[model samples]
Target chain A: MNVFVIGIGLIGGSMVKDLRSLYDDIKIFGLDVNKAHAEKALSLGLIDAQTDYDELKKADVVIVSIPVDVQLEVLPKVLDHIDDDTVVMDVGSTKLKVCNVVKDHPKRRNFLATHPIAGTEFSGPEAAINGLFKGKTNIICEVEKTAFKLQEKALKIFADLGMRIRYMDPVAHDKHIAYVSHLSHISSFMLGKTVIEKEKNERDIFDMAGSGFESTVRLAKSSPAMWTPIFKQNKENVIETLEEYIMNLEHFKQLMIDDNFEKIFEEMQDTNHIKEILNGIIVNA
Target chain B: MNVFVIGIGLIGGSMVKDLRSLYDDIKIFGLDVNKAHAEKALSLGLIDAQTDYDELKKADVVIVSIPVDVQLEVLPKVLDHIDDDTVVMDVGSTKLKVCNVVKDHPKRRNFLATHPIAGTEFSGPEAAINGLFKGKTNIICEVEKTAFKLQEKALKIFADLGMRIRYMDPVAHDKHIAYVSHLSHISSFMLGKTVIEKEKNERDIFDMAGSGFESTVRLAKSSPAMWTPIFKQNKENVIETLEEYIMNLEHFKQLMIDDNFEKIFEEMQDTNHIKEILNGIIVNA
Candidate 1:
């Protein structure tokens, strides 16, 4: 099996790491626009060799793991080169734009739109780790649009990688992801900004920040080059989540101003149900 | 050494858990307004026995780990009962109010104001775990106000527990804590609220939420009984941090509306410095 992984960053590099250990006959190729990242991934033993789009035609499977904005330009070209039996899948965070970009393509049936909800705050090829997708949810957007044979091939790969699959429409995937993923990054980034603006003494933040603050602000360390495009692609839904989040913060502040400790206490008590919800995630994950 | 844990909850329970392992001569006592919690702590071996305020006169060290509002009411009474040699320390998140309330007390020299920057989302005696304070920061406020001998006793305990100590004025501690601690809770709770409100289907959150969302919203599961008092006690500083946080969110939203991806990218890029800052915390932690 000839497999090509485009954009050899955390996601793509990690996928190949798992794939190499899972299969013996497979030859994994890394295709990155950044030559340094490709070399780094190769040196890290994340791939068999480095290749580009010209050789994509030989790929039995092409995994598109670039930033969402870049996927808009690159995915269609990827589909243009693959064989009729070849399967192409994208692991972008936002799904609607990419799904729409290839909705009317000649080989539309060969492509799968997926988002494997797994990653750390760090980025780049060096950040990749084995088993990143294991026990993590991989949302498949518009899976029915892909050819049955191609779908089966992708599903086998995901199964081998230990990913739980959930299917949803592209629009709903984008909206739901805005709430679960995109909004988290924004809230975290803004929280970091607010703290940095106030605590000019970085030493104070280091000394004073507890585990709660560390966990909450961890996402602020994500790569902007990757996230800016996700926020752009899912602008409407991201803005909606942001507005609701801002309003919620404002309402809590008002409760504080009114000296409504009773109400403030009630609000936190109500949100405590997230504990039970997150427990299920941990078990499933 | 006789030690009395006045709250027998996560913090107090945890303190005794470590203290018990470190000192063979120490006999730990639990005192709680809730009889069940005191009994639970006794059953869990978090305390050697259950005791009350009348028994406080015998305590060599009284660790107050209750809500800040309750501390305002119960702390002075605690000081009145302790011996001149006994050290009464309150581990509430807020410091200024508690410090002022005991400022003129007859046994003020026996009181120590400290906030140990450690804990999980869970609360109560069962939530207590050994080594919870290991390598964590303990902020001691108004140390100069305490007697030198009592300070040595408290600092020794902190050091023995593997906690790094830092001294600060109560006013400055409250203000700095608002940004790093209080504001993170508000942001996390509000993020959980925003998502819970939008995703009426709880399963959506359970399935769609990734590690980032989980970490960002983890504090939403914290005990309101504990946090409400902390926010109320540090009202002015918490409010100031909230206003700045809300402003930053509003600004980010406007940038989204204006399609200013450049500025959004730059904003996150600038905040990426939090990575280095947080690395220091992880190292020191």
Candidate 2:
């Protein structure tokens, strides 16, 4: 089987790493707009061959793992390039935009919109490693839109990688992810920005950063090229979530201003439920 | 030598765990307002015995690991209760307030203001684990205020636990910590609150939380009992940092609302410098 992985960065490179090692018979190919990433992926043994989008014609499975903005433009093209029998899937973060774009396409049955809930703050092919998706949640939005055979094939791959698959509508996927994923990124990024803006001395940051600060700001190191698109693609949900986040922050600030430590303490106590929710996740780290 | 550990929660419990294991001669005693915690600390062997504030006279070393607000009210009393030869120290997050309160005390030389930059999101005795302070930074504020013998004693203990001690002025320590530590907690609590409020479904949070979300929100699980006091004690610096965090969030939100993804991307790119600083620290996770 020939597997074509597009945008061979962290997600795509990771998929190739796992899939190639899992299936000895699979001949994996890589396609990335960044020539250096394709070269890196090939050299790192993430793929058997470096190929172009035109070569999508030869793939038995095509994995689109680029930024959502690029996926918006490239997914349909990749779908159109592949034959009906081929299974096309995306590992994009935001699903609604990509699913909506390809939903009307005649070859929609061949495509599956998946958001694998796993990643580190780092990015690019160099940052990729094996077992990145192991034991993590993989959300397959609009799975019913996919053909049965292709879905089974995708399921087999996900199973081999030790992912727990969940199904949801693209609308729900977008909204909920804005809360769980995108908003966290925004909060972290802004935190790093705010700290940098306030501290002035990077040396102090290096000195004073505790595990808590490091953990809270870890996602601020994520690839802007990747997340910017996600934030923009899921603008409304992200905006709505960010507004709520800001309001919560502002209210907490007021509590501090008013010296209402009791209320502030109560608020965080309620949010401590996040511990239970987080415990449910299988961290790839 | 005797060690009296006040507030038998994460910090004090962890300190006792390490101190007892490291020093066979050190007879550790515990005092906590929460009886269950003191009982649990004794049961877990975190302390040799559960004692009370009145027992301060019997202690060779008094370790105050309570919340900062309580520390303000209790520290002077503990100092008065302990003999002049006893080394009294605090492991509170905010040092300036605590240090200021004891600056003019007759036994000020007996007191050491310190903050160990180590913790798990979880709290209380059960959340306390051995080696929480290993290879982490420990901030010692107003070191000059401590007697030479006591400083040597505390430094030896920190060194025994493999802590890299950084001496800081109490004011500078509190301010820098506000940006690095306290701000992270607020951002995380607010992020968790916003997500919980918006998602309105616990199961969805459990299903959708990625490692990024989990890391960013991890500190939200911290004990409000512990943090509320720190926020209240470090109000000015925290509010300043929180305001900066809010402004940054609002600006990012505006960028997203305007579809100015390019600026947002640039902003995150700039903040990615956090990676360099984070990489400088050893993450115990």
What is the C-alpha lDDT profile of model 1 across B16-118, one tens digit per residue?
A: 9999999989999888998999889989999988887889999999999999999899999888787778999999999999999999998899999999999
As a whole number from 0 to 100, the lDDT of residue A106 in candidate 2 is 92
Q: In model 1, what are the clashing residue pairs, if there are any?
A: none
Cα TM-score per model: 0.99, 0.96
Q: Write down the TM-score of model 2's second chain.
A: 0.95
Give me the runs in candidate 1 sitting further than 4 Å from their true place: none
In model 2, the runs with Cα more than 4 Å from the true position are A282-285, B283-285
The per-residue C-alpha lDDT of model 2 at residue A120 equals 82
lDDT (Cα, tens digit) per residue for candidate 2, span B1-285: 899999888888888888888887889998889999888888888888988777889888888988788889899999889987899989988887888899899999999888888888878888888888888888898788789998998899889988888888988998899999999998988888888887777778878887888889889888898888888888999899988888888898888878897898899899998887787775422
Q: After superposition, how far is residue A154 of candidate 1 from its true place, in Å?
A: 0.4
State the number of backbone clashes in model 2. 0
Native contact fraction, candidates in order = 0.92, 0.92
lDDT of 2: 0.87
